[model samples]
Target: MKSNFITKITLCGLLLNGIYSHAQQTTLEVNTSKTITKIQPTMYGIFFEDINFAADGGLYAEMVKNRSFEFAMPFMGWSQPNSNTHSLNANSGIATPVRTSQNSNNPDFCRILINDDKGYHIINEGFRGMGIKKDAKYNLSLKAANHNNAIKKIILQLIDKDKKVLGETVITPSSTDWKDYSSQIIATATEAKAQLKITFEGTGTIDLDMISLFPEETWNNRKNGLRKDIVQLLYDLKPGFLRFPGGCIVEGRTLENRYQWKKTVGAVENRETMINRWNLEFKNRQVPDYFQSFGLGFFEYFQLSEDVGAEPLPILSCGMACQYNSGELVPINELDPYVQDALDLIEFANGAETTEWGKLRANMGHPKPFNLKYIGVGNEQWGPEYIERYKVFAAAIKSKYPNMIIVSGSGPSPDGAFFDYGMQELKKLNADIVDEHYYKNPEWFKENATRYDNYDRKGPKIFAGEYAAHPKGVEDGLKENNWLSALSESAFMTGLERNADVVHLTSYAPLMAHVDAFQWAPDMIWFDNLNSFGTANYYVQKLFSNNKGTDVLAITKDGKPLTGQNELYATAAKDVVKKELILKLVNTSGKAQDVTINLSENNVNAKGKLIILTNQNLEEYNTIAEPTKIIPTERDYKMSGKKSVLNLPAYSFTILKLKMK
Candidate 1:
């Protein structure tokens, strides 16, 4: 009797399994012969902002903070540690900040007066301490004026938290006038939290400016370049374009603090330093020490885009401040300079060597134009004021460069009065592209997967300029770069791809953050002084970008696109150049999904590649310690005739690539 009971239970379980499998099975029909639209090369890209120490302390490869003594607090990063062994007292030396009238761009310089040779030294606490590697070389540079030939020699050393010198270099004062000095220091051991110590060997006075340090091994092995590790991650993504120097930074808290391209170009030292808008944007995460050194300026941004094989899409200010802050506006009559800035930027990027701005670009080492085709007028601005300013900018830019594509702003929110108004006005103006931003919960992303399905085809194209799925509502304080958020974004991106004609460009916002000094959460990448890692969302983006085909293919379930049907979303594209069919399926449910893709044509090869990215735990995310916690796994897949059967795991994003025979 017991055996019979066990057998009966097993049979019942099998019956239930069969029923569930039948219910979950989905058949997607792909029209391989019909090309819906030509997918834009700029469809998948990166949006870069300088927030969260992304530039000065993050990517710029500059180890020294307050390099030019130009921070609001001149000696913010410099501190004089009293040493018991050396008997260094306060009277040993005094460094006073001096402002000279000659150089307004870089007016501040430190003047050190040593009373005695009692070991007077100042240490720079590098952006939360430097990361020195064993056997690696660090290049140190500084400008010094040995006043009256008083100071004899200066010694520079890299020290750890315990003050153990890892490397040292010395420079002898050979001139009374300001002279440039550079030396290389080779470390004996690795230290993640190291500091730079500068000691004066003799008594008297010395004027110092632009004290900078960088790893000898930079991204391109160029002097004063970007962090190699960080740039390597970006290069691997194969992004189509790079939108840069943005977010709220383009529109400063006040007009005076806005990011001016003219000031950022020319010379590195002459680029004025300003307080970062994010310095005090969040009260709970205020970083008063945050500032922009502009070492990685406009030229560097363009070079980085080129190095990574991406188009440069630069966003400029529209004579208006951040609405969340001062909201100061330049009168319509006085907007000539702002409009000229846009026109001049075009010349700088695509002009000839004889042109004024192009001459500056050539002088900066890149004689060839960046071939810039897109320029954004403003960032997240709304209302009639924005439309007014945008109209003026549009007219001026069109008059000069009619073929140039202008990316106009559509406010901060994805939908509302501001977004609606901006869209209507831009359509009336026949705008080339409109930028939209979205920061919402994971559910919102999944629910809005078909947001662009009904968009006007003849109107301006969409640039999903800035977007990220906050796992929890941003206010709940539970924002994380977890698998759930990334999975939801993948699901939503299927809709973005399905409507390829409407959405031309897309990128995840807040590209990078310093793990130790970040003011924002949910960034795509995170890094510290020593290392960096891409979040789960980063892999999702990578898969889409790397596999974005040349043309879109119609993939439908029950004669309609599969978007949030039975917790599944999908899009298909054909890589004409590679002669392959690409299918992206995202299952956002907890149960495994059985999907059968039926192709209208029988040209697909039996052998294909399948890449799967999934995590049972939705909250799982990547960190510096466990960077590959949720990376993609790939394997060979076999297709039967024109039908491909796939069992997508719970909460997963799957990609199937098959060659056309």
Candidate 2:
């Protein structure tokens, strides 16, 4: 029955993608005897802010982006603005539908209403005065009313049955264009039904547009904001940190083009600017065109870390420009202001009351410093420009925030002298860490696991910023692996574990890419708005990251090759706080293997609890058409201990946590 069921499920499209039944694999004797796996706490991360899920704008934004928010724009008598993430601007070519005349009633957030259909409104904003209801304010224009003159101001008021003020509006004189006059309303009392009255108080007809409202509480953190549903999935992985914004988004066309810190402040629509990074056109769903007004900004990144019990490792832009797809490296002299931006950025993150940018931090509601510990200078710099700019930024920041750890991002080539040269440069600049990325073949991974053995721990530490094993891809030049990739990844992790103190932190980057909406391939977590599922690489990360311990424990296990193919990659550590021994084991063999575990030296031995992720076939994948096909499962292992042998299924990953009394 089970075989028939799998046959039916696998038949549906398994043959379509060129996947065969699980690949025939072989295993060889692997060892825990001589290998000393270091146990270092890793700051495992996903590109949560904008890389994986676009959950900004609450249900509306994520829905619209996902093409799920299906409201007819010109819904008969009902009307609403374009409501795209970006503001409706001519230069931006962004548009929305709205009602603004006597026959047209604006439902606050629905649209801006102009007196009986005769003008326009533009959203004008700054930091302090933009609040949803409490601090929100707006304007109206009648410029299109033929003989109507430009109004100096407009007194907007909302009244209930007894005539109590429920909302208020005001206009400004800066009218080169039809500008927006807006403010949040703090009704003396609550009233569901209210009437809006625009007291022109000036020589002109009145016009109004869309007005948006949000409780002050909901708008607090915008960028790194994860929907509860998405957060729940992420929380399950138990990651230690998050990499915000994105690798390419950090370096914009111009300084102003760069993410503006000031635009993402406060508790209202006015204070935020929406600049999202993903554009889903399949369903007319567009995101990244608008920044959620960045309602959730940098300050929120810190808060999110606290919320998820993770640490914050913020990176600064190096002066060197980024070629999103061109893959060209800019020369050094061309990158200057960008370097300074890096310096001042740190001032904003960790400076005190005495500094200018720090005062902005204080004004943003976090008076005390964010205490940002890890500050990466540049991201994936491929040219000499990145190297030089990194030095300048490193000097300035280290001079100011001496205690901060400066991380360096090296390009993909291991043979590239840049890493060696970059490492040598760090010694002079007193760099705290070096970022090494790996996007390679399973065999290369097997060869590269010990790549850091020659690395000097006495020197700056290291971080595996972006890495994955794929079937021969362009970026990593990784060759293909049939069933052995999972085990190869597990093998690489063994080295990371054995060298934890020196490894300091590690994260698998470009963590996710929506399959059809992908800019990059073979992401750690892949999904669309409707559904999401992690990849095999993600499982490897989850297995290793979730079972981390505060200190390394000496462990020993002996086993022969479970199969003729490369097999059995494993790591072990003792959890200091829980008094438990956790072992991460992976079997690349296509068949089950019996393994003997000896834990007599660690003292109190108890039955082991296992959380496993196994697929009947190795080629199983998640797609937009069917998203839940391949997900990890958790099961309890029946036995353990010295001379005790147990069976491990093939092409699978297992994380075993054994408790000690």
Candidate 3:
């Protein structure tokens, strides 16, 4: 009798557990008849900044260090290592960089004086170290003013850690004045950390500036171009828009150092070098060698946008320096030149070939216009001074080009007195688009999925210009780029797509970072000398951008929007081009979720496709060693009649594509 009673109790417990599991199941209703808004093509995009050695050492493939000799501490990256560390004699050949007062912009050049024949060598440690591949060709170039033709030949060699030569080239300085010299070096072996060593043949002094080395095969095979592998990754995303030239660097430490677009165009050599705003951003990641080479300047930005089939959106400084640093504002009288810059840029982008700036653009090999449509006034500025300056810029731009859309900023944070003031003022001024930035925690992102649902529908459209969920505080210790943060962003991205009319454009900030040399943590993409890989955040971005639909459909549960109810969130869209209905679902729970989606007012095929991205651990991330660790996996999904039931795994992002009959 006791054994029978125990068996009955176990049966009862199993029955009760089954009942509770059934109760947890939910139903989602997607009404295709109720089209909320038309989705814009510029919905998902990329925000680019020069932070974290993103340009010179990260994107630009120039392997030479101190290319222009323009760093604050000239010859900071170039070093002369003694043959022996404990040598008694202090004397060896020396290379001394001299600065003249002839040019305020570029004033430094290294003067080499050879004393001992002990093979005096000056070695350049590349941004970290140059990634050299065997059987590849490298171009070595420099400007040399051989003093009285003192030096006979300069031998340039690529060496590895043990000082083994991988490649070699010889350059004979034939110019008495400053002139350019170019030679090719063919590598004999592969090395991830290679250094450029210059060996002098005779004892003499030679002035060298703009020392540069680039791969013979660059992006689009253009001379002095960007890294091919990095550009390829960007092109694969099919991004809608490309925001160029900065985050805080657009607003320099002071007005004198602010990024000037005019200085970044025309001849690459003539383009003036400027101090990067991120030079000392993080005291821990201090990089005194960081500076803008301007080789990948405005023209290159537009060219990259064109190459990726994305709209080019440029942000310019609006007469004010970085408020965080100096808060220096140009006086109203001196603001004319600032306003004139805006006008000239529009002409340079869209004007006819007969115009002055347009002629310059034509001379650079692009006769046709760049077809620029949007321009941002400032980056994360606020207060009464910003409003006053924005008013002047808006009026000037409107007077000349009324159809051009101008983007204005709403301070740094998402909420505050300054943000509120900027939004209210921009709305009153009839601003076209209002740029907002956020760098918060992952929970903040999941909770704010409906951030744009209550925005003023009739006001200026939103440009979520810069945003990323920091796993910990951005200033906190060892902030990592993990799956939890990227998954939360995927949840928030569905909301951005649902409210596409108001949220016209969005992108992740600080696009690329070098692993060894970086200031900011939690970047979207990371790279080293020869290899680059996207983070979990990058794949999330790729899924949304590549699968962005033409129109948004209403997807609700229990007659209300699904924003984290039962730890599940969802959004629906219809792709008229592909003749399919798309449903994006997120499950942020520990247990699997059983969901039955009912599609009304649309005849669907019995078979569909599902792409799911999830991992067993939330803290797991994609690194250079394993980039595809958290990528999406696709499978064929079949529907029963007009309804489809799915068992969503815990902490997963799933996308359903149902064909329409």
Once superposed on the true structure, which residue ranges of model 2 sit more than 4 Å away at CA? 1-38, 48-226, 253-256, 260-293, 323-340, 352-355, 427-430, 472-488, 513-516, 526-533, 554-566, 600-602, 623-629, 637-641
What lDDT tens digits, residue by residue, belong to model 3 across residues 482-511?
A: 888888999998888988989999999779
Q: State each model's CA lDDT, in order.
A: 0.91, 0.51, 0.85
- RMSD (Cα, Å) of model 3: 7.5
lDDT of 1: 0.91
Candidate no. 1 TM-score: 0.95
lDDT of 1 by residue, 595-615 (tens): 989999899999998888889
Candidate 1: regions farther than 4 A off: 1-23, 83-88, 473-479
Higher-scoring candidate on lDDT, 1 or 3: 1
lDDT per residue for candidate 2 within 1-661, as digits (tens), equals 0001011111234452344333433222222233244454444665543432333433112211111111232222221222234434222212234433332112212222233222233322111112123332322222212124445555545555564666665655455444444354454444433334434333433333333333322222342234443444455566676666556555544333455444454443334333343433223434333334453566666666555566667666675445454344445666566666666667777788689878877876778876667767766665566667777777777776677777787665455686667667766666677877777777687666666657776787777777766654333211122224555677677667766767877776565654333434556655443345555566667767777865554433334212112466565667768877676667666666655566544454546676665666655555545544544555444443343343466666767776655
Model 1 lDDT, residue 223, Cα: 89
Off by more than 4 A, model 3: 1-23, 83-92, 100-104, 116-118, 473-479
Q: TM-score per candidate, in order?
A: 0.95, 0.66, 0.93
